[model samples]
Target: MRRRHLIAGLALASSLTALSALAAEQGKPTPTTKEILAKSAPAEWRRPDPQNLLVMQLPTGRVVIELAQDFTPLHAANIRTLVRQHYFDGLAIIRVQDNFVTQWGDPNDDENGDKDKIRSLGKASKTLTPEFSRAIAAKQPWTPLPDGDVYAPEVGFSGGFPVGRDPASGQEWVAHCYGTVGVARDVAPDSGSGSSLYAVIGQARKLDHNLAVAGRVLEGMPLLSGLPRGPEPMGFYADPARRTRIESVRLAADMPAPERPAIEVLRTDSASFAALIDASRHGHNAFYPEPVGKVGLCSLSVPVRDAKPVH
Candidate 1:
């Protein structure tokens, strides 16, 4: 029995060696991420719907976020109402937790602020049904990753958002990957009203299924992430002067066509995306002689491009 096992192992090793030799002879180097994106077809990119795009102007620059309405419709709608009413305008980025999140909202909403100065919610709800997760729809576009996850049964991309799923429960939620925007809430699950928001700047998978995800930052992540960390616990700015004031927050639909941002995001379900994933797992070049052979869900960022002008 021991001899038989040894023979089997030797045969497998020989086959692997032959395959390696064949691959070396082919001389086909793994394509870099740049090459993969450059070869992507036009159909593989999608323009975010104007209604779902939030354009936030800070003193530094503009930050564009794409709302995941399909995953969290209530939160998305509430955010939309708040934007239409200009609720976020003049609000401040009150927190910058190093390697965690950058938060922005009404500074008055914080513990030290004057209660009387708190901003009104306008027509938006003061509390909303917690959209932490939802029943996975059969028709939703889910491009699943091959690599496993520690937090959930499955991990994948749904409409360009990183997501985790549990097939047994038929539920899925937006993952707290970098640049993911989540609604801020109090102790109660129902307290999140989309009035306050935070963008993840580091690994925060622990937040999955705990907070209602509103959307993701399609551009201007540097504007959010490259800020000074606050002194207070949880990174709240101790001094009011430390907060970064929001210039304006406008929905793309509210802006004129010419004023709207012209950007496109690579479709998560495209062949190029699959190729990119495979490349991430197995690509090798002069710099990286050996493939990593594994990829985490958050390690990949979907590519974005400025839209080309039409003749």
Candidate 2:
């Protein structure tokens, strides 16, 4: 009787093992984002130049921006000067117009704050030549997107920035997709001096020619995008108490090596980058049996990752 019970137990265990195997087989196999990045070669990643990197420390976290120096050189230079002069320190995020922009600068410039106490731009220029768009030439690196664009004759990326180009007009400018930082100015075209900047937190593509895109947020977009929406018109926070203050803005070059944000951005020209784009462009999963094969220009944000210091 004991031998019989032992045999029965062994049979039950075998049956349960087979059932578990079948359950595992029932699930579909899909390669995740993490898996793809893991397979990327070391050479596929590039570190941004310290000279062009802006480290904005907010109350919530650190936000890293890569200045689009190629498109807005003068604004880039002035912004760097302003950072070195510490012009952005203690400034508050004044407006968070939902689906528009998260603006920051001197609250004094706004109707809500004391205008007399506005911070000076110091040695930085008060105005710069408008860099709204530049002539697209053969010398520039080009990686055109696969699908047709709605706003421009062609859409693609160049130097890590999403670009909209008109071959006929020979003009190319950065798009105002999420995390794009633009220089705010008055009615005049050349009024932007990089003193006041706004990050694109919503669909503000209409502001393309109306403003100048100076940079793209490389990291910490959540710190800007996830903030509570302002109550006033155009998303301005009516209550000054509700605004988030800037702790400091530092050029990565000015910071100590230990203090800098060490990150690796996937090279848009690399084969791995092409693979990444193709993954989304040709992705098919259990949930999405019919692949959405075409990806929009704005949706093609290159992947960025934090990296350990080289020994």
Task: Find the candidate with the highest TM-score and give its number.
Answer: 1
Clashing pairs in 2: 97-235
Off by over 4 Å in 2: 1-30
TM-score of each: 0.91, 0.89
Q: Which candidate's lDDT is highest?
A: 1
- lDDT, candidates in the order shown: 0.87, 0.82
- What tens digits encode model 2's per-residue C-alpha lDDT throughout 127-163? 9899999888568768888887788889888888888
lDDT of 2 at 165: 91
Report the C-alpha displacement of residue 128, candidate 2, in angstroms. Answer: 0.7
Clashes of each: 0, 1
